[model samples]
Target: MSQLKEIIYNCKKATSLIERKEIGRLTLRESVELKIHLAFCSVCRIFRRQSITINSMVKMLFNDAQQRQTKLDDTFKKSLQERIEDKLNKNGKKL
Candidate 1:
């Protein structure tokens, strides 16, 4: 049928739906269309797999960065603040 052909042959729409599904749930129509397209399209299937892998890797990197975040010591912070205030005072900026 023409509808089936349309659903299975639109690689551009299929890829867009794949990315959209990654960020949020697709509508029932979009979900069905994407599933149909992916089933028939090997390139699109490979693209979807690569997209999922890249997303997972990026999420892991961000989580690791957040977990290892550090802050300046209180002494260092105070010293930096004092230096900033001194510069502002010298520049005639009220704080």
Candidate 2:
């Protein structure tokens, strides 16, 4: 594929390079590519905002739950843990 097409396609990959970027870091090349993709791809742009909002909500909820240490319960904790694990695994990182 052409470089821009590849970049757009890459932006669509995984939770999206843009989304993965919020939870972690991206290489210089990947970051540059994503910025380029976001400049033009409206779909990825929307996905970018959604990912950021989801992350913010999760962090807010998780922090509140942690402070209370009462309302979270096992299911919520387990689901959050699984989501974290999945993200890490997809990124080839380890906790």
RMSD of each: 4.5, 15.1
What does candidate 1's lDDT look like per residue over 18-42, in tens digits?
9999999899999999988988999
User: Which pairs of residues clash in candidate 1, taking residues 3 or more apart in a chain or in different chains?
Assistant: none
Error of 2 at 18 (Å): 1.2
> RMSD in angstroms, candidate 2?
15.1
Question: What is the number of backbone collisions in each predicted candidate, taken in the order shown?
Answer: 0, 0
**Which residues of candidate 1, in runs, are more than 4 Å off?**
70-79, 83-95
Model 2 clash pairs are none
Model 2 off-target regions past 4 Å?
68-95
